[model samples]
Target: MNATTDLLPEWAQRPVSDEFLQALTARFGSQCSTALAVREQHGRDEGSIAAPPPAAVVFAQSTLDVQDAVKLCEQFNVPVIAYGAGSSLEGHLLAVEGGITIDVSRMNQILSVNTEDLTVTVQPGITRKALNDAIKDTGFFFPIDPGADASVGGMTATRASGTNAVRYGTMRENVLALEVVTASGEIIRTGNRAKKSAAGYDLTRLLIGSEGTLGIFTEITLRLYPLPEAVSAAICSFPSIEAAVHTVIQTIQMGIPIARVELVDVNSVRMVNAYSKLTLREEPMLLMEFHGSPTGVKEQAEMMQEIAGEFGGNAFEWAERPEDRTRLFTARHNAYFAAVASVPGCRCITTDACVPISRLADALLQCVTEADASGIPYFLVGHVGDGNFHFGYLIDPANDTQRQQAEALNQQLVQRAIALGGTCTGEHGIGIHKQGFLLEEAGDGAVQMMRAIKQALDPKNILNPGKIFQLQ
Candidate 1:
């Protein structure tokens, strides 16, 4: 078993010896599973990538359990993939080379809350919404939403951000420390609860967005923000997509302290209206939020309204009550699902690209024009305040031409993002579908450096093999 280089088979074709199986069974007992349902669930995520199920699933309940699973898989020279809430839009959960998936869902526990320091320690399995819920009693909250109630581990793994990111920043800024288990079964804790540090080597930042290729998170220590004293949300409609985007551009340029500013095209608004039973104006619109003192929130909203009106923002509505605020955000978060339902029996080949703030309108309009001209159905949404947007090209999965058309549009948008001095992906990481564009964006030299790091960390190539550039 120790002679992996000479004895291992080709990829997933490597046979799992009876002795290895017996060892796992004896050590973990009922925590180990070979159930078809569990394996299939861990094999894929919300993305459109097709992959084979993992050979087995282990429900990891603690950092030690994760260590045991990785140590055991290393003996058989098998891959170890981490699983969170299974809500990732990318194929981060897919076991492309068939290995053992460590389901961290059972490790959902909040370990500590340092209210004085505005930090909390939690297991990797806790979801964003759950974390906020758990800390609501303390008056401090975590701000990296990322739309879905994604696992904190998954969010940190992907370096996720959401609407609030326009003002509060992303996970990259909010995360302070992490506890990781390396491929060699060694635990590494990076950072502390302090607000600032002059530490050697920012390993926490390195592992945050590694996407489980470098190591898996066992516990996370995150920065927290106090709940705003006053909050306000508004919906504004524009005559055209360009007008709406221009408003966002102008608002950001003015340095408005908006907590969240989202853009929705007429098509997306129409779908949401039908699916959620809200008669929002069928025009390009912006959903905005502001947080501060009562007087400050009022001042911000008034300033935004004045700017919105300058750019043909009509039919503006405000949601100040808690119920109203919930309704507005719930509909916004459900937009992706509602869009898929709008086109019956269709799956989306989603596009996520971010351009320079000045080039936002150009990047968005070009893709919208092309998609409309191609006669394909799509729903457009964006965190426009940050120059990031998405287009869900809904197509029947069984239709060859539609799939090709969707992919073509996705490539065009990604290329546009890169050419405009921006990124190929703003939030959604480079999963299997976006791997082709990674090298195009990062270039050969940078990708090679990444590969070198991957090789140095996982020499066995047994940690989530075939992800983030297919190193070695």
Candidate 2:
């Protein structure tokens, strides 16, 4: 983990005084917990990064609850970390500076839905699936999946995207307004339900990817889309990863409106097969979906089939039944867990690098070659149509050497993506794990500008302290 150490913030944890704890417990009673188990749960996320548990945990049930917790922390000069569904992959939920975590999971609810306006306002803690389920009868659904049943607030904080991001945009584009609890415990609103607002600074965009550093989101208003009239999913296996990548690149370049297109490398395919009990072809595969009118879906499928065939892709399979499509996508989403399960007592250092479409082949191929040569076990998967992909390099938790090797591969991959005019992170925000990469990718001037905003908005630097960029 030495290689990863350089990516962490250079800050020491602040002590949580007895006075603060007593005050918090008095204010919230049972809702505030100092128990080790609850603190441990609030301290980490899905990623491999580790930290000491937060000093305390506050289970917030509503916007007022969050605001009160923030106020208490602010008064005590203690850092506050906002926690959602705990699905983040970049250590976003880690209490790196030893603060109290405000858990908003209990705040899950659909505040309002405007079907006629194609928008919905929700509590920060509602998961994407839950929101869809509550509004399924309304013939509208939110498209930002992020593979996890992550809280909508978490998605908004991290600007999350997933398989559907290719056609529909990421949270940065989909989120319309936010009700936020600021560092000083003041509640504020940014943006509104209107589609386009030439209004003041784009505070909504500013906070979308802030990773809980700018402000803690209590309520989020998001754009919604009507359920497609016709939906179709297909899978095609390629002779090699390059062939599959080329197929996707060509498909995107040709302006095909693919709803979702993902790549599963040979290694991931095998893992998925064993984990999901489905005998998919043992080759690099592209799982694709198209959404539109029946005729339009057919035309898109035909076009994809033709393009894939031109690249020597075969074993084309179509899944039109709802159950079949669900099964296939479930397998796809389970790829990460399957890989982890393959290696007992191991965690992975996942790299999220996205390059230009034309440079995707070069970036991916180089990373694959290096990962293969490094002798580190890894699984590759991607939302390739959008030139964004992930390589989860499995590393034994007890083996520091493997951790270093995985971090080296991640560093090389991020550098390659940056050199190719791409970003170090396409969807995952810069948590403690990617702080250095953010500096390298955004440079000092841009980062300083961001820091200035942070200083202005959170002068005390208590909002998810020790994340994104180092303060001093």
Candidate 3:
């Protein structure tokens, strides 16, 4: 047996027998699968880097099933990787250590919607779109939209955020509580539905972005918001990239309550237009949204326009109708894939760096210049209003030279972000891809504290090992 496997308790090391497999089949007939191909498919996430398959796959349909599966894994000294929608960009779901994948999609269900308290409880496997659709008629909405229709459980696991994050806040702010299955098959509830409480430790916040390291989230209670009285979206073009970024900076500085403020470079604009079948001017653009009473939205729009004018921005192209706004934002949301589609058969390497507002322009300019000088085709898009931007590079991984160049550029970008007192990843958690960078960002002492917590919660190291940090 391998050193790691030898260390596992006897139960973990024993191979599944026909009887055991039959038992699993009897319990979860359609959900249990011992097929190598199926297990391999559920092992990795959406990242382009390393991928390791799990030993088995179990499609969990309820919290009880999750608890039982975890118990079985614990008895065998095997790892348990929690699987959601498998849309993670950072390889958070990759089964680095072979074991079992607890597929949570079957558990998808909206448990309850407490309209009176503006909170909803849901099974972890439920997708964000499903939840929104379920509550559409209630005049309430869950605003932590991450663009991909990712699962609520996965969003909570990664503390995900996207366009509306700048306004409605990320999962960290939306998740009020969680029902988690711990490493040892212990079920625990963290937090409550109350808006705020001074109660003990904030365990809910701790587990919000644990990425399945601390526990497997079985259910989540999230705060909700009433649908806005009015909503409007606009595309404002700028002659230069700097001008577009400056408009965002100034608008935010002026305290304009923008519902959404996103910056897309000219190159990305062309790609998006092509992918979405829209003929928009191929210029640097700021896609924005305003929400409030009709008059308030109009006033905000006017204020934004005035600020844009000072920066040489064009008149707003409004999308007032529901279908129009959906089409526009959907196109915007697909910018990453659109850029990837520009180069057929090429893989995408996306890197995110967040800097202080004062340094965002300089940082973005540095990235653009570096990418240009490296001769690597890339796309620049960002939540500029929040000083976080993503650089998507299309590379032929088969070409070693190109791969090295991309890595060099990524390292430089991350180092610069650290120098500027910013995080290596703004929203994406520190999965395996960013472990080294995370250590550098957190320093030895802080990293040590993180290790202490990990050990305290999972001494056996059977839950998503080889992630976040390398244990001593």
How many residue pairs collide in each prediction?
A: 0, 0, 3
Off by over 4 Å in 2: 6-9
- State which candidate, 2 or 3, has the greater TM-score: 2
Q: How much lDDT does each candidate structure score?
A: 0.87, 0.91, 0.84
Cα lDDT tens digits for candidate 3, 123-198: 9999998899989999999987667879888899888888887788889999999999998999999998999989
How do the predictions measure up, each by TM-score?
0.96, 0.98, 0.94
Model 1 Cα lDDT, one tens digit per residue, 413-458: 9888999988878888876667768888999899999999889998
Give each prediction's root-mean-square deviation over alpha carbons.
Answer: 4.3, 1.2, 4.0
TM-score of 3: 0.94
For model 1, which pairs clash?
A: none
lDDT of 2: 0.91
Identify the runs in model 3 with alpha carbons over 4 angstroms from their true place. 1-27
Model 2, position 151: C-alpha lDDT score: 92
* C-alpha lDDT of residue 204 in model 3: 98
What lDDT, from 0 to 1, does candidate 3 have?
Answer: 0.84
Order by TM-score, highest first: 2, 1, 3
